[model samples]
Target chain A: MTTIITAQNLSKSFGSFQALKNVNLTIKKGQIVGIIGANGAGKTTLLNSILGLSVYDGDLNVLGFDPYSQRDELMKEICFISDVATLPKWIKVSEAIDFVEGVHKSFDRKKALAFLAGTTVPLDKKIRQLSKGMVVQVHLALIMSIDAKILVLDEPTLGLDIIYRKKFYHQLLEDFFDEDRTILITTHQVDEIENILSQVIFIREGEIALEADMEEITENWMVLNPTADNIDAARASSPASEQSLLGRTSFIFNGVSRAELEKLGDVSRVSLSDLFVTLMKGDNDA
Target chain B: MIASIIKPGGYNPFKALMLREYWENRRAIFTTPLVIMGLSMVLIIISMGLLGRAIHIDGQSYTLNEMIANMSAQKAQNISTHINQILMVSTLPIMIGAWFCMVFTALGSLYDERKDNSILFWKSMPVSDLQTVLAKLLNVMLVIPFVAIGFTFIFQIFLLIVGSFSTLGTDYSAWDLLWSSSNLPLLVFSELTYMVMYSLWALPVFAWFMLVSVIAKRSPLLLATIPVALVILFETLFFHSEYLARFIGMRLTGAHILQTDNGFGQNFSILGINTPLENIQSAAKPEFWIGLGIAAALLYAAILLRKRSSL
Candidate 1:
């Protein structure tokens, strides 16, 4: 497990507003990590800092290169798709392929063309003329063809239909992801990518509220459905969050043993979305 | 290996970036001059067809063929010189079209990307901000001008060939009168030299526009032009001198690229000279170099702005 990205005390501010607070993180190779946060929680800001698109205060390194100063050299191994439809609208599909082939050393033009061959995106049509889903497909086709070590995607499937969104992640996992590659993704639709992510980091108010592997999350976090009489006993375990619906209460507990939780009520594994909401709510409450 | 696939000599990144600039703005850089040339060719053919009818110039009536036949050799030489001059001057419209293309392209190069949020896509590439800005500068300063000149020269040759046919049955040899009298090679060399020098002279203006394009939030044209206008206005109001205004005017029109007897007429006389290289010497002055220094500084500033800018 080689560390590919290391951040120490990373912070960014615009005027008086701190977008990213004193943050520390380490991402290793061969891991698919999801950075989950609410709106304005500094998810995009963190991604920008990692991509060297924004300036920051504090030490950060990606693939042994300083992202800010050595971005050009760093980009040789790092590819990013920042939101859907970021590709220029005026660029023709063929021109886009030619441009990527010309600019990116690691780009495989034949693979990209092969990928596009299966789709309905016309090579002669400009990007603006394509539908939104088709544009994302074109962008994804180009990016997936690049033999980059790290793929950072920020809302890469935003505003797309469920079919396209599923296809996006499906292609990413099937064709792009491997032991030699890593992916860092951020999106509001957490459940859509939950199955693909090996690790998840929950951010709130510019700070990491929780970071854990999928196995660790399943082992340590549990959602217990407690009856009205057993609710007080379940609260004794210090649940992170609680929600009640139709006279039934679900309490998300962290670090409490399954045996202890089973004593109070029925316990079930915590879903990533449920754990994400629990951790974020706990941060807000604190 | 990927490195072998993208070896330095096999594909120059700078050249590719420049090619990308050309690709993005092909309509402005290549098509405008070509369309203008096509239209001019149609007009030239129609006007040549009308040459057979008698025409009155300065109250003297003569058919086009008789006018060429009746002139003395020296008089015909002068008429040939003037005719070549008119043909050379005919390229002005295309040149003007190219100039407008250069201005808008420079202004919109950085601004358009930022507006569309494609700056992120561009910044993600391995090319640095410095290379990107320089590629755009080269596009406006070198590529567009060269393309315009190439089209103009071809169109000029076509017109000269057509003129030779129109001048048949006259005493004057159309080959000697039009082609031989016109110093075509020297004319081309001077034009190329003039364009290169003019790019240097006008560097500050283009650099300023590019800087404005990167820095301004919106309406970059207004942001680019208002400051120069204010400077001229302030100079007129406070100092009662037009030096700043005149200097900007001269740079924009490339008046300082040559030592003309009169500022306006020397550009036209580029074709008049047999040895245009000797006459095309740039104005050797501290201001010229200083202006270049200013341009370099502005370009550097644009690169810095681009590095820091994000959507």
Candidate 2:
């Protein structure tokens, strides 16, 4: 596998507050990596550093270029959709397409127009006139049309309705993702993108709590639903987290043997969101 | 260093950036001049209707029909020259409007993008910060001025056509008198020269406004002005010197490089516009080069600020 992005001892501070603290990370090409965090957990700060939108300390490289110093060259291969709708309100839809096509050598005008053809975005209307959902759709349409090596989406589907959000990921997987490309997404809606992510990095309080491939995470982590009678035995096993609902207790264990957990009760694979909650809550408790 | 920054593989994106600027500011760059011209034309037509058959030039009255009937070659030439001068002077309002448009555009160009967070979108493209800032500066310095000048030339032609229509049935035609004797070519050349000189002279001020736009989080207008106002005030109260005020005044008004000994209001003689050699000589003035150096420094600062400005 080809490593496309690497960060070593990356630190960033805003005045007296530290946003990112000596974090290290690596992402390989062709992986759909989800950067899951709570609000203000340095997800945006990290993504901004990657996009060359902000300065930071220590070493970081994207496509062999320093994102801050060589942003213009790096941008030719990387594209992003920020959390907010950033298209200028004064710009018409067609003009936006015209401008991107004019500047980006890899921008496909017909592809952008084709994407908009499916949506309610009119070519002549200014961006301000569009609904918030349509504004996001327009931004998405613009980004998906670019032939970039990496796509960094910072809450790209934020505030979007369920239907659009589902279609957004579906279209991204079907039309945009390939072996030559990589995707880095940050969102609070962990479960929404869980199925598409090949890998996950859980960030808590500006530090990586866990970084693992989906296969490794699912294989090693298990949710054990212990019967009431065996609850004490499950507790003795020292699970990462415990939750109770409808008088039934469920314990999440990381790296405990599946057979050993099965002895307590029913043992099943853990959902990404459940794992994320366990890891985050476990860190909080610690 | 600046030349080298733009010297390598910068042509296509630079042109695209210019077109993008045109698209964004088409109203301020193109329509402001035309609207000024339209309003002035209407006023001119209404006045011609009210002040019928008597034309006034330089406070001298001439009965239009009789004057043309007995008009001499010298008188015809004088009237033609005055009419041409009137056309040129009429462009003054448009020029003032263009300056206002330029200032407002420069003040808002970079600031508005950051306010709306569209700077993120622009930065997502492959264009360097240098290219973006240069495109904006060019719009203020070259685009607005030339658009204003073009509309002014069109308005001159429109007035000449109206004058020709006024002399429709006369034995002495405006075509023979006004058109033949008109120094339109020299007027155009002179106007071009004046606009170029004015742009160069005012470059630093425009650059300062743009730099303020990049740095100000809000109210860029106040940010651009209040500092200069304070500096001038501080100099008055403490240093008791008018050095900064005079320097700003010279930059704001026409400088010797732009104005000849006869001044702007005089007739457009062939000798009126400075010769190429004289223009080159005047450009060698220390203040002119100093102003350009300041402009370049301010622009460089703007580019650096824009590069790190996440907001």
Tell me how far the alpha carbon of residue B72 in candidate 2 is from the true structure, in angstroms, after superposition.
Answer: 6.2
Q: Give the TM-score of candidate 1.
A: 0.93
lDDT of 1 by residue, A116-156 (tens): 99899899999999999999889889889999999999999
For candidate 1, what's the TM-score of chain A, rounded to 2 decimals?
A: 0.97
Give per-model TM-scores.
0.93, 0.92
Tell me how candidate 1 scores on lDDT.
Answer: 0.84
Collision count for each candidate, in order: 0, 0
DockQ of all models, two decimals each: 0.59, 0.52
lDDT of 1 at A15: 97
* Candidate 2 lDDT, A78-117, residue by residue in tens: 9988865688888888877777776788888789999899
Classified by CAPRI criteria, candidate 1 counts as medium
> How many pairs of residues in model 2 come into backbone collision?
0
Please report, as a residue range, the 10-residue window in candidate 2 chain A with the lowest summed lDDT: A277-286
lDDT of 2 by residue, B20-48 (tens): 78768988988899899999888878767
